[model samples]
Target: MADGQDLMERIGRLRPAVRAAGQPLHRPLLLLWAIAQAVHGRPRQQPWSVVKHELAPLLTQFDGAQRGERDVVYPFWALQRDGLWEVADSAELPLTSGGRRPTFAILEQVNPLAGLPEADYNRLIDDSTVAADALSTLLVRFFGANSGSVVEALRLREFVRGPIGASLLPLVGEQYADRKKIAEAYGGNGVMGITPLADGILAVYSDDKGPYPDHHIPETGWIAYTGDGLSGDQTLTVGNKSMQEYQKQEKALRYWHKPYNGSWTFETWAVVIQCRRRWGRGEDKKQRREYVWVLAPVPSPLRETWPSDVVEALAQDDKSVHDDSVDVIPAEVVAGQESRKLSAQERYQQLSDAARRTDGNRTNRSKPTLVERYMRSAAAREAVIIRSEGRCENPACGGHPLERTDSGQPLLEVDHVNGLARTGQDTPEFMIALCPNCHALKTRGAGRGELQKSLVPVARKLHRAMQRGERRKARPDGT
Candidate 1:
């Protein structure tokens, strides 16, 4: 029988997938949900049918970036790896040929019961002190300053220790002569954009005149800050590390803005609500990896005055990290910006030249935002759509549906042949246009890898055919 300390240690050592896509919370969240169930004296074991129904909403609320039924399936089955969970009818359970858990549909049919083992459940239920210790370990380790909100959300207030929410610095906006003056006021080096100040406050400087220009989304009161690094792709170190740490801890950021011609002015309190890895041109006028942090502006006066939505978003453990480099631009926005028509061959040449120049050694030292990536890849996406000519590019796909978009164009999604995760080049030769159904299947289907493999040659062939002024209308019967 594992004691409370043992359980706390296990919770602390949870091995979530370490990827560029941010840490997955599926396991920790599942354990926390189980702890919540224990607090309410629920049964030790519950079927997947019941657990998914109850846990799906919590997962959706805390893990907003991940969607669909698959999210719930991972935690329910994967938690067993930590040795704290178990499943009934183990031999009877269905699994894939590789001895792994089957799809959620297959698991649903089996409906095996799973949860914390009997001994662990009994310990958590019988001893309130042990349960509180375990809950505190999970909350502090995963939720940080947002633990209080998690407690409230899970109705675990009775099991938590210490006060919730860190004390924030007072609303003080001032003007500084230069970086040195700002550094003297704050604790970190004045030269860096993101710096650590006293009492866990982050000093973020946005210089409009510099290579990285910050953009403000007025609708959400969010600032999309292009992260620090001058020559090449940015890494998780130094100023960028501080930004990530503060984001995970849900600490407030002391923002300052430097206009093109004016002195540095302290802005307002902010928090890094979201962060994404995107391809941006660096100092050498080539595409390089960059981190774009979306900082949410906090209301002034006091933390108590913040709206409920702001508070809730700050409490999310995932922080909605977008790992892909592609910045999705609306089709309408692309059409509006690219009014000058270029032939298929001409558009392909432009993208090819851009790709060749940005071979990782150089990048354009401009502030790369959603608009920048859109302008660069708009031609690539359009060229692929044009090549498809109202037909699905997937050779195996049935005829595209009769549905048309609002503009009377065929409804299709442009996808990279190698996938964005693999850093697929955003060029006409490496892209394909697919109908909505085929696109979804390619993205999330079990055979997506096979499908992606099949599309690679197809995309190349189509681009060549289109260049020869050949229009290959897709067969209605998928011949």
Candidate 2:
């Protein structure tokens, strides 16, 4: 157990390992969640099953600095380093070949309990003044005035003196003076369509009357912005690639909108969850493939209301990017190296084999500092949709929603059964195809847990049937 004063100091200075990743609230949020549980006189340690379900939503709700994917495993595991927390049977937990912290899946496999150190838990329980001071420190130092309903939500209202004050982040619906002011404060290009700011922050500018009109989804808390590149085909490069980087890093994109002849207003913080290619006329009046990106607004001081489905979408999309030790070959990496035409099934097999191997963790004496990033497989997505037989896999939604995308593809979302973070597998066995309505219910609706458990077996059985050469049920077109 750590000394009480030292523990409090560590909590105050809580920060992300990579400082340039921006001031992430993962660790702080996890700590607060633990504290809240302790305040309620719950056990000092709790199972990962409970933590993942409860703590993850809290992280998503509060840590709005990042738009996609909250690092639930990192804060839960890394907190032990700060000496304020501990994990039961931690010594028995499996690690990667590099001996680093294992992925969320491995942790779930272990199911080891974790929480505040026994001494710390007792201290908080024994002394109300100490607990109040600690809660105050977290709310003020980390959350600031944006602690919207957090105190009440966490049942820490008795400790808080009066209502938490103003938010530090730019407020939504507030008019900013001009572009120059926003750039000065956030440190991004004032003129470019996409500016990569310091600390992995992304700033995107949209104009109501520009060549690309960014449209809002009525009452949906979402925005549809065309990808950067006003002339010719918009290849994934420059500003467009920067948007992908923000999505890859799970950071929010600060959006600023300029109405025709109106002062530039700070819009909302959003995550690039879905992107599709479509034919459109650029500024040059030539038809070409333009990328349309769907931005999901997360809960932040800038925004007040959030659609339940949008919230579910954010949580689901965020899990697509996991920092597990598993090795996944990106499409770019494979495309750069391979010359042969591999079928989608072959590609799926190859990628799954690569993910199952631990060579990525082996020591590279020559290039010891090489970094590996995981990318989802296109083949896996295609395979699941085809296997779904044009129906929702939920078994309750009846069939796929009677909606077709602009490209004529069935409007179905391919979701992982156990989450990519838990399994680190993008293969069909670990995934399922669902209509938008079913997908939302699986993520945030009541009885989501039962729904999740039911889908795991459904996905596995479907994959087995596919492997046995079952004939795929065709769509109504019969093509």
Candidate 3:
């Protein structure tokens, strides 16, 4: 069995689902927030703004993408695939603007809450072994041989210089403002994270008329990608109709696109879109912005006609490239899935792991696994009582916190109304608080089947009431 230190490294080395060399700075930035959160005395449930403001500087400093601020968008959506964080929203994913992702601004408007898992969140604060291992894993996995400068830039210097940086105190004041540069700049001289595209890449937007290659940019100018594609068109305004009408535009934008005369026979690409609204009446009010994409036919040929700045960036390799082999990613980080029956300890870990993931909603499928359906925790059960206000939800038995425990606490048991043992979900909707007698009648009584059937309406009523109460709080005076 792996020891504590080895497991810590394993957790830190967990990679985000992205392209081989794509730089997803959100992972490291999110990790930093988790660490700093422990250093401070902040709670595990963090609002979107906390991660947003704290992570901005890190994004600006180290994000290798064309626009660093846009980095928050993917983490809000994509980081859910990794098992270390979770979002409060469990609904199906929202629609995208064409194939392009929503910017940071849009995500803030849409998402209400997100955070690290409660167990992991609490552990990183209290456990030095875990924290140190996480730090080491992130450093070695991303920075490899060059973890020192990154440590300084990320404001982990004091911690890094310590015998074991994981024991460093909670950071105070402008935590992300160390202002140190990383060994590599995004898309500039970064040998790792970003894979540089050679000049002369060509992609085409295919119509019945065949591929529409960009022979030259129109007078309006355009944004260039390392691949053969363009950014949102700047010349036109967003949404020609009301804001809702833009949905139709996105569907229209999804026409067939193919690589023109490229080694890869076919290509799959996505379009990014946006809307620019101005104050006006009727049709004059909206302008729809479109960012269409196409794949490149060749890798290193389109140099001459490329934008001057892109050409210049592609040529700025004056500095010696660093060795990426030293980064030391563990083998399991790249392995495909293998399954086995989870032991009781593994069950608890999976529950914690699932809680922290941004995309942790495995039960939304038609036939979710038995384990996936039953991953609940002590906190989750307690939340049911709090949400239920400690009343027996059985309509036939209106039991409150009448019985007192030996500890002088209310005697109530949190029961899975639909029975997780029968493959029911362990979510808030399926849990209810019950007094001892009512609980037995519902779970083990000879008439339990009929009793459970009767309890469904009561459970749903309580769920709806709690939901309404939350909705009111979300909007004061029903505004």
Candidate 4:
């Protein structure tokens, strides 16, 4: 048997050699999920049902939709080869790609048999330092696919430097208290008798290899968001493309994506899973491989179809709501006349307090400033909407936002012209109004990036014209 030092080193060296396109996040995600459970007094060996419930959404969140939900089962069973984890199964392991097959009869509360060896498992639970070291190793190894080195990205925490203790673990604290809420939401008996995702929310298409509805990906299927999570007679009520039409389109479902200079498009949310990219046949070895589309509601669909109250509660935490469009109320940093230097302890405490107070407009020093930001976003939205005149600003594809919203207005969303998360200010001059389709097209791929760059000229022209019109309105003082 590998010693603890040997095992830890192996865990740190794990990589996504499994697939070409995607870095497999299964083992790392499972480790994080299991660690969180163990830290919270739940056993390290979680039930299959509980594991599925908690880990599937996280897998979708961390891993791109390229892999299926069954992928979650792999690390649970296969980690024995690596020495960090072991699965206690009754039967011989199955040989399918994703993982061991699960029986549908699952009791959510029942704990299944699985974990590290007894000594290792006990050490993990008894000594928080060991757990933190393990978590750091997993995070740094798996998330190496991210923009920068995980060490650099996570350096603010001591564990990222080297594990100080469980206290220094980034994912362990209340910053992730919202993980439970999200997990429970995913775990609940999801909407039945129809597909679960909203109409426009695109996902990687499945190989269509499996039985009827049992596509290997969990919560995987496109349930057109009719209303109340029921299929509107399985009609194309949400977006321009209906399921029937999509089925008939000779283009493989992989190619059935939004944007791409196509006549019609579908929108999807992805970490890097930006608007779906279909697999292609190049020459030999059968061109490209396809992803199994999972049938769970990503954040966008959850916002639209699930109960508003539920979404609000989930989104209440700043870190919880994963949607880019969801507004988070950032605390206004009130600059004191003479700032006193904080002690190291004070600095940590201050940061801790700030992390917890994510709710809107706390009545503290600058109680009223959040409204100013609210006004800016609101005003920018209205101006962009009016400027677009309810038509898509992208002259090439002037599609409406699917159907009109209930407010009797064209369904248009305000998007930052220069990119919101990057450098763009959320003001009228920097924002553009787009129908959902155009928005998707504008956001994905190198070709689309060029398109966005070209539209900058168009957006500047609109801004100049608007400025001119405003001067006309204020002609008395136009000089």
lDDT of 2 by residue, 1-479 (tens): 44445545566446454344445777878888888877889998999878877777777777753332335777778888877679888888887737867677787678789999888888888876567656755664455435656786787776544443123234556576676776565444667878743223456778877889577743344676788998887877888876765555444566778888887776776767655454456786555556666677665422234455654554555423232212333333345557875544555555455533423443431211111111224446656765665567665674446567654557899989877656655567888988998888888989788889999998888777766656545445442
Better of 3 and 4 by TM-score: 3
TM-score ranking of the models: 1, 2, 3, 4
Instruction: Tell me the whole-model lDDT of each prediction, alpha carbons only.
Output: 0.67, 0.64, 0.41, 0.41
Score every model by TM-score: 0.38, 0.35, 0.31, 0.29
Give lDDT: candidate 2, residue 435. 91
How far out, in Å, is residue 428 in model 3?
Answer: 80
RMSD of 2: 21.0
Could you tell me how far off, in angstroms, the CA of residue 124 lies in candidate 3 after the best superposition? Answer: 0.8
Ten residues in sequence with the least summed lDDT for candidate 4: 224-233
* For model 3, the run of ten residues with the poorest summed lDDT: 193-202
Best by TM-score: 1
- Local accuracy of candidate 4 as per-residue lDDT tens digits, 44-107: 6755666666666666666764455455665766566656666665355334434444333322
Order of candidate numbers by lDDT, starting with the best: 1, 2, 3, 4
lDDT of 1 by residue, 123-189 (tens): 8988887787677556544555456666788888866544432222223557887888765554457
Give me the runs in candidate 3 sitting further than 4 Å from their true place: 1-13, 16-24, 90-93, 97-106, 158-479
Best by lDDT: 1
Which runs of model 2 end up more than 4 angstroms from their true locations? Answer: 1-166, 196-200, 218-221, 245-251, 299-306, 315-479
